[model samples]
Target chain A: MLMILDYIKEKAEFINQALAETMDQLEGVPPVLKESMKYSLLAGGKRIRPVLVLATVEALNGDEEKALPFACAIEMIHTYSLIHDDLPSMDNDDYRRGQLTNHKKFGESTAILAGDALLTEAFGLMAAGAKNAHLPLDVALTIIEEGARCAGSRGMIAGQIYDLQSENKKISLAQLEQIHRLKTGDLIAFSVRTGAHIAGASQRTLQALTEFAYGLGLAFQIQDDILDVIGDQEKLGKPVGSDQEKNKATYPALLGLDEAKRKLSVCIEEAKGKIREHDEIRPARLLEIADYLLSRDW
Target chain B: MLMILDYIKEKAEFINQALAETMDQLEGVPPVLKESMKYSLLAGGKRIRPVLVLATVEALNGDEEKALPFACAIEMIHTYSLIHDDLPSMDNDDYRRGQLTNHKKFGESTAILAGDALLTEAFGLMAAGAKNAHLPLDVALTIIEEGARCAGSRGMIAGQIYDLQSENKKISLAQLEQIHRLKTGDLIAFSVRTGAHIAGASQRTLQALTEFAYGLGLAFQIQDDILDVIGDQEKLGKPVGSDQEKNKATYPALLGLDEAKRKLSVCIEEAKGKIREHDEIRPARLLEIADYLLSRDW
Candidate 1:
């Protein structure tokens, strides 16, 4: 288990490096705009989504190299969302990942353009990846379309809209679940499913992986909500009780902290159970990820 | 000539309808956000880029249907840039294409998201187009990469950065040309070239088209600069002298109005000259476009 954890970490680092190199190509941009994108992108996170993509592909005995572009694309999409979410018109966050947000480092206009650049570049990278991998055109096309759906209105954007409108309003637990599933879960599902699709996994296997991702994603968001209410700011790298301060609805707000934690545990268990039918090689790394995410203090 | 013009108009209207239908598929976005995207996108414009794409494809004797998705994709990209440029953080303009800007109608946050959504959806549309056309993977990949380059840092975004930084500065005529060429010329070139490539045009044809587009694009920008300094606001649908008021550099500022107009004429002639080697079918429509662009009074 420890070895598997270390392996995932190494692969995550590799994906992060690839992401940096891909973003570094934007150096041709004016120094200010390029720096703005780099400031937020390189500020560093766990690179969990990219890792999930790499790990899932590896578990399916797929070429890790072939999956690298989609991994990078997913991270770019995630980064763009963070940048926009931190803007004054949105969440208005000044700090992200324990540093000044993109808008604070670069003016709002540059930040906005940087985010747009990242999102557009993600598609370019994905297309280049398809060429590099020699994948079937249909496969590459499917991945691009599905990835966009996950990131666009029916997915993350919709989740954000719901989040914004739900602010300061008391919403039901089902509505909260819908928001998180779309906002957070859909992308995670895409990360795993995209890898599986690239690897040409059996439809049955891909379906199970998706269910596993869905449960894990929900668990991840619930843990996040619990952390917001009770976690330490030092570890979380963000102010605690921010959700409460902003009257933002969360799993904890809907289910209470204890209930949220219990639900998270159940989600983790269910996610692991969904993948049990898979061979040891394919499910082991993802199961470990579910454990790590649900148990993390931050 | 009239028959071909009618065919082009019919295709353009079909492309417009396709674009509108595709945009209407943006489910789950907030009504306000959806309205914002639609408001700018549906606002009447010439649909020039997409029309150029279809025209190039037709001129190459390729199936126009195969190019439709790309046609819509370029327009989406163009619209997204306009939406972002009209934001308060950027140009701060309240009007575009004779209508209120996206930011004015939807607020800054929604406008930003609308742009993001449009850009993301463009990729989705391109992928779908690739699938529908049954083109080879490499061709589809190239189209996506070229489109991304036209929209990203070294292309439209870079142009915007320089435009912002050069505000209030006394830039040389050469510097102004570089800015507009990157901001506007690169994408227009990409629009023509992508269509040709998708149609499997010869290297010689692609090269000739690139030169033609560059000349035409430069002329287009010079005409815009000239219009801003002298045109009536009611006809232009926006206030004139906006560049002067904002201290933004323009061709007229560096080259005088008469010189700018003369330069535009030279550009139009050069653009037409490049395509003279091609069959009459290729140069005819493009030359007509150049003339129409330069002849516009507002």
Candidate 2:
């Protein structure tokens, strides 16, 4: 456990440094626009997605340096989605990760453009990185296409619209899982798969990693739902039962608390099982991440 | 003139068909999301950007089929920008091309997501197209990077922020031009450059085409300003003098109506001259397109 903690910390620091350098290199962007983009992108977080990318690459014995741009690109996409989701027209949240939301700090218009710039520049960075890293053109193109499909209309955005529609309505557990699967699951899967594909993993290896990814994604969401129901207000930075208060569909809402926790355990175990089956790949950190999500309180 | 008009109309229909087929192929997107995306994309216009891509490829005697994906990609980017620009937080316009703006037709959140989807999927389509077109990897990477850079923070988004900041405030002529140059000019320049680059035109040809693109972009904006000041209202699907009413800085506002018209003429002539220098490329349609903009009212 301690070793995994140290690993995450080290990789997260590396990711943060790369992200900061990327922002510094954006010389052509307007100063204020760059500032807003950096605010969300550089805002300290668990850096889970990027860490997964690096860890997966390392697990596959690939060059971590070659994966850095992709790691950064995924993080940028994540940050942009958060920024847009926080807008008045969307989730309308005032704070995120203990800081003023983007639209709260920057005006809505700037916030929107910042998100736009981040999303657009993410592709630019990835393409440039692919060329610099000397990745094969076909591999680069496939990875790019995967990123777009996962993050675009058919994936995360689809989840968003569905989530919006499902609000204030009673939805079944299957429907709830479907939303999380597309909304957050696809990107997380893409992050891990990107690392595997870049590392030249076999098709069988890729398949195992993908299953592990989806399991981890679902477990993460279920944990969030569980925490929202039974979490410390001060520690969680929001009131407990807020999901219930909003009539939002959640795992615990549909299943009893004990059942939800049991489901989370099953997800974690299943995820770890998939990784363990590929023991030759050195997936210690990936397994640890699944366990971390299972036990995390906030 | 008649020939150029016919060329545009014919190419626009082809572009429109391709766009419709692309939308039909998006089976994974939620129906509502797809509907909103199609609303803006298929709303119909002169299809200027996509047409330029095809025309430039044709002028260089390259495979028009190979350039179709890029042409569609540029149009998608253009449509996405318009969708977001019409959002309440941005331009707050209620009508575009004689139809209700995206947010007006669909709710604000869906509209925002639709714009995001279009932007994201444009890259996906381009990547897939690059592979199908069998474009050289280096060339594909360069073009994708160019699209991202031009449409991103340092380019169109920068222009949008600057334009927002300068609203209702006095801005210098150079500043206003700078805003439009980034906002609209960069993408226009990208369109022509993509076609030229894909057709494997020489550095000299690319440089000339780039200059022509920028000139035409500025001329188009200047003509828009001229129309806003002195042209018919209903013909434009919006009222004239709207820019004046909002105190928005336009070419005509900054340089006076007659001077702005003169500037437009200069831009058109210079743009045509650049193409004439490369008569070996058979740039008649490109030259005529510049002339078309010079005389367009709405």
Candidate 3:
């Protein structure tokens, strides 16, 4: 357990440093824009997505150095989505990760531009990083295509729109699952797939990882729903019951708490089973990460 | 003039068709999201940016078909910027291109997502297009990097932040020029550069086109400011004097109308001179395009 924790800490530190250096070295950008973007970017999330990228690469015995930029780029996309979702017109979030939301800290317009700039710069970083890392162009292009698809209209954005529309409405469990799968699941899946692809994993490995990712994503979301109902505010970094206040459809809200927990256990086990079946790849860290999510309070 | 008009019309039609086809062929995206994106994307603009791309490629005798996706992607970025700019929290415009603005027609949240989706999908289209066209990975990566840089924090977004800041304030001529150059000029310059780079032009050709694009971009903005002051509302699509209403510092507002016209003329001359100096490349059409900008009302 200590080893897994140390591994996560080391990888997180590496990613955080790369992210900061990338921002510090960026030139020609306006100071205000940089500040606004950096505020949310470095706001100290758990760095789960980027860690997954590095972990997957490591699990496949790939060079983690070459995958660093893609990891950072995914983090940027994640940060940008959070910024936009916190906007007054969208979620109207007053606080995120225990700090004032982007629009609350910066003005709304600047927040919007900050989000735009982060999303745009993510692509630039990927392309430039691929060039620098000497990653094959075809592989780089495919990864970028997958990144855009996961983050765009057909994936995360679609989930966001659905989530917004579902606000104050009583949506079914299946619909809730669909929304979570698209809104957050696709990007999470993409992160794992990207790491594997970069490592030159075989088709069998990719397929197993894909299944593992899908289950892990759903389990992650279920735990999030459960946390909203029972999480400590200091630990969770936001007010509890916000989902209930918004009347948003979530697993614990739709399913009974016990049933939701059961479902989460099922997902975590299924996800672990996929990883365990691929023992030749030694993805023990991924299984540990999945278990951590299952038990995480924040 | 007739030849130039015909050239613009032919190229615009080609671009419009390609843009429409791309939208139609996009799979798995939500219908409402697609509708919202398509509304703004297909709105009748002059298609100036994409046309420059095709025109530059034609001048260099490059494969226009191979450059088609890139041209379309730039247009997507342009459309996304417009959608975000017209948001209620931003410009608060009720109309664009003589139609209801994206947020006004589609609602704010969807409009925001639509903008995000379009911007993200543009990168995907570029990567996929490069793969399909068998464009060298390095070239494709460079082009994508340039596209992101031009449209990101250091370029278009920077200009937007500056423009927003300068609202209702007196800005200097140089300051106004800087804003426009970053906001509109970088992307336009990128359009020409991408076309030329795709054609594998010489370093000298690239440098000349870079200068030409800078001059042309500034001239285009100056003409736009001139039109805002003295042009007809019917031809211009939106109302006139909106800049004055907002107290925005435009070229004509900073430099008097006559001086702005003089600046425009100088820009046109300088831009045309660069192309004409490289007459061995037979860039007469580019020269005509510059002249057309010098006289265009919309």
Candidate 4:
């Protein structure tokens, strides 16, 4: 467990340094906007998505350098979505990770532009990655298209709109699943699958990785909902009960707490099952992540 | 002139049909979201940017089919920016093209998501174009990077942020020009240059095309300001003098109406010169469009 944790920590550090360097290289973004983007991007997090990308590459014995741009690109996309979701016009989140959110710290207009810039920069990085990594044109094109599709209207944006419109309304579990699948699952799956792509993994390997990502992504969200209801504020670094306060639906809200926990366990189990299928060839990192995610006893 | 006009009309018709078909083919986008996206994208405009894309391709004798995706993508980007700019958090305009703005038609959240979708979809289209056209990896990568850079923070979004920050405030002529160049000029120039790129034009041709686009983009904005001051509202299709009402800076405000007009002519002349430099091999459409844009007598 500790070894896997160390691996993630190292990967996270690499991602952070790369992200900072990328921001420094932005030639034309205004300084203020750049600052806002960098601030949010550099804010400490688990860096799980990026780790998944690199670990998947490791599983396939692919060039880690070739996947670095993709790892960083995923983080940029994640940060941009966080910034936009925190806007007053969107989720109205005032604080994130115990610090003032992007809009709170940098004003609304700059925050908006910062998010826009990050989103743009991510795609630029993805395309640039194709050239920098010497990946085949079709593969690079596929990655770009998948990344955009997962994050765009029919994907994350759609989830957000559905989430917003479902406010104060009774949303069914199926509808909630649809929203989460779009909002969180799609991007997480893209991250896992994209790494597999960069590594030139087989279709079978990619499918298994995607299945693992889907299960893990939902379980992660479910854990989030559970934590929100019963979490140490000092450890969590953010307030709890905000979802209920906002009249937003969540796993625990729609299903009973016990049922939600049961679902989380099921998802984790399924994810592990998928990872175990590739046990001979897959790296231990993916399995470690899946197992560690559900174990509450730290 | 008549020939070029016919060319533009034909191109616009093609773009319109392609855009309509594309919207209909979106797989997972919700019906309401699709409606919102189509409503804004299909709304009639001059199709100037898309036309420039194809015209430049034509000028270079490139495959029109290869250029179609890019042309559609640029228009999508243009539409997305307009939708976001009209949001209540930004410019707060109620009408666009003599119709209710996206937000006014759909709810605010839907409109915002629609814009996001369009923006994301546009990137997807660019990548897809690379595969469809079988362009070389390097060229495809370059197009994607340039598109993202021009539309992202350093370009259009930067202009938007500066414009918002400068609201109701005194700004210098150079500052206003900076804003316009970033917001309007960059994407316009990108549109023209990208088409030249698709044609595999020489560096000299690309540079000349870029110079023409830069000059023409700025001049187009200047003419817009002039129209706001004195042009007929019915022909313009939306409320005039809104920039002045918003206390936003404009060419007429900074350069004075007379000086602005003189500068507009200088820009037009400069743009024509760039086009004429390639007269031996370049298509006449580029020069004709440059001349036709500012000429009131259709």
Candidate 5:
């Protein structure tokens, strides 16, 4: 456990350094725009999505160097989504991850541009990664296209649209699942599969990783719902009951709390089963990441 | 004259068809979301950016089919920016291209998502273009990165930030130029340069196109400002004097109308000079495009 923790820490430091370098290239950008972008980007988080990218690459014995930019790019997309979601016009949150939200710290205008910059830059980073790696044009372009699709209308944006429409409305469990699966699930699945794509994993192994990550993403969202109800505010760094206050649908809100927990546990185990069935290769890092996901309170 | 007009009409039709085909793929995207996206994307406009891309490719005798997706992608980016700019929190414009603006047509939340989806899908279309063209990976990646940079923090978004900040303020011509260069110029410049990039134009030719497009873009903005004051709203579609209403520092506002017109004439001449000096290629289409820019009232 300690070794895996250390591994995550080491990979996280690499992502942090890469992200800083990425943010430093904002020549001629307004100081406020740059500052707002850096604030949210540098705000501390678990770096789960980037870590998943690196871990998947490692699990397939791919070079971390080749995957590092991609890992950072994934994190950028995640950060931008959070910034935009926290806007007054969106989720209307004042704080995120224990710091003032982008729109709160900077004015709403700057924060909005900051998010736009981050999202746009993520693509540049992705293309640069593929270019720097000397990947084939088709392969590099396919990877980029995949990232776009996973993050765009059919995936994350779709999820956000559904989530917004569902606000203050009573939605069925099946509908809730649909929202999470597209909104949160697609990007997580993309992170894992992108690493596998980088590593040139076989179809069988790629299929396994996709299945595992899909289950893991749903479980992660379920646990988040559960945490909102029972987790400590100090540890979580945000107010509890935001979902309830918004009357937003959540796994725990629709299902009973115990049932939600049970469902999360079952899903995690199922994800682990997918990993274990991958020709008994023993993907230690990925399984450990899943374990950590289930255990984290924040 | 007739040939150039015919060529422009032909390319514009191709772009329209391609855009329609692209929008038809939003199967699972929610109805309102899909409708909102289609509403802005399919809204009739001059299609100037896409036309430039197509024209540049034609000048270089490159494959228009290969550049079709990229041309559509530029238009998508243009449309998305308009949608976001017209949002209640942003420009608060209720109409664009003579139609109700996206937020006004569908609602703020869906408009935001629609803009995001349009932007994301544009990148996807670019990648798909590269893939379909079988362009070398490095070249394609470089082009993609360039587009991202031009449209991202250091370019279009930066311009937007500055524009928002400069609202209701007296600003110098230099400052106004910077805002327009970053906001409107970079992407227009990008539209020209990207086509050259696709055609693998010589570095010298690319440099000429960049310089030409830079001047042309500024001239285009000045014409827009002039039209805002003197042109009929019936022809321009949207209301006139929006810049004055917003206290925007336009070339005319900063330079006086006569001087702004002089600046526009000098710019058009300088842009034409760049085209003429382009290794004697006789880029007739580009010259006509510049001429059209100088004459267009809308």
Candidate 6:
């Protein structure tokens, strides 16, 4: 257990360094725009998605250096989504990570451009990823296509659209599940699937990992909704009751808080069970992530 | 000459149809989001960039069918930029091509996401471009990388930042050129060069085409500034003198209208001279475009 925890810590540090280096490349951009991108990217958050990519690749016996570019790419896409989602026209939050949101600090126009810049750069990084992987061009292109699809309209953006439209309206549990699947689950699934795909994991292993991630992603979001409704603001690093204040429909809103927590526990159990099917030596980090996601108070 | 013009028109029509068909593939997206993307993409501009790409590829004896995906991808990137630029916080224009801007019709958040969707989808198209081209993965990845770089921060977005910062400020001709080179020239050069690169045009030809596009792009922007200063709103289909209203520094702002026109004339001449160096027919369509751009009353 200590070894697993130490492994995660070390992987987190490596991914964080890669992300910082990728962002530093943007310094060659116009100073104002570069500053705007750097401000949000470096604002400090748990580097979970990148760590997942790195860990998934390693679990599949893939080269870590080859996966590094993609690890950075997924995080950039995730960061850009956050910047846009927090805009005044969207969730309208004033702070993220206890720091001013991009729009608040840089103004709306710059913030919008910063997000645009980051999103475009993410593609650049992905294209560069192929070269890093030293895989055949076809393989790299496949990975990129899958990742971009997971991040785009058919995926995360669709999730966000449904989320926004569902606000202040009555929605069913199925609808909420659909939203969470796309909004949160798809990218998480993509992280694992892409890592496996790039590392040339076998079909069975890739399928297993994807199923595991889907449940894990759902459980993670459910826990997040539960935390938002009942967790302390200082610990969460943002205000509580925000979803309710905005009339945003969440798992806790559709299902009672107790029911939502129970559902999350089920999801975590299922995710763990799927991970258990893998070789005993592998999926250790994924198992830990599933457990931590459900157990964390924040 | 008339036959060549007819040929170009036929190719443009074919490319336009392909673009529409590629976009129509975005069908399964939520109705509202799909509408947002199609609203701008199908809004019917001249389709000049994509046409240039197809023409350049065909002129180099490359498969036009193979290049169609890239043609569509460039247009998507172009449309996404227009959508974002027209936002209330950016250029803040209410009209484009005689229609309400995306933000004006769809609201800011939708417009923002719509732009993001288009940008993300563009990579998907480019990744798919490799399949269409049946080329080596390395070549296809290079096309995507170069295209993204041209459109992203070190390219178009950076150009926009400088343009926004220079508003109402005294700036020199060199500074204005730098802004236009990035904002307008980079993408145009990409359109021409990417096509040539994909077609396996000789390095000499690609270099000539790039130089030609650099001048043509600058000339295009200078003409646009000139039109804004004196063109009719009714004919242009958008308000004139917007630059003056926004205090945007332009060619006319740096040089008198007469000198700006002279500079346009020189650029047109230089662009034509470069194209004339090519062995295949002198790109008469491009020359016509240069003339139309510099001489348009609107």
Q: How many angstroms is residue B167 displaced in model 4 relative to the true structure, after the best TM-score fit?
A: 2.2
Taking every candidate in turn, the Cα RMSD to the unseen true structure, in Å, is 1.8, 1.5, 1.2, 1.8, 1.4, 1.9
User: What tens digits encode model 3's per-residue C-alpha lDDT throughout B132-190?
Assistant: 99998889999999998999999999999999988988888889989999999999999
The lowest-lDDT stretch of 10 consecutive residues in candidate 2 chain A is: A233-242
Worst 10 residues of 4 chain A by lDDT: A289-298
Interface RMSD of each: 1.4, 0.7, 0.7, 1.3, 1.2, 1.4
Please identify which of the two predictions, 1 or 2, would achieve the higher DockQ against the true structure.
2
Point out the worst 10-residue segment of candidate 4 chain B by lDDT. B274-283
Q: Please give, for residues A84-104, the per-residue lDDT of candidate 2 as tens digits.
A: 988888877777766889999
Task: Give the docking tier of candidate 2.
Answer: high
Prediction 1 TM-score vs. true: 0.97
| Candidate 2 TM-score restricted to chain A | 0.96
Runs off by more than 4 Å, candidate 5: A280-282
Ranking of candidates on DockQ, top first: 3, 2, 5, 4, 1, 6
**How do the candidates rank by lDDT, highest first?**
3, 2, 5, 4, 1, 6
TM-score of chain A of 6: 0.95
Candidate 4 vs. true structure, TM-score:
0.97
| Candidate with the greatest DockQ versus the true structure | 3
What lDDT, from 0 to 1, does candidate 5 have?
A: 0.86
lDDT for model 4 comes to 0.86
- The per-model lDDT (C-alpha) reads 0.85, 0.90, 0.91, 0.86, 0.86, 0.84
Chain A only: list TM-scores of all candidates.
Answer: 0.96, 0.96, 0.98, 0.96, 0.97, 0.95
Off by over 4 Å in 2: A233-240
lDDT for each residue of candidate 3 in A34-98, tens digit (9 for 90 to 100): 99999999988888899999989988999889899999999999999999998988998898888
Question: What does DockQ come to for candidate 4?
Answer: 0.76
lDDT of 3 at A239: 90
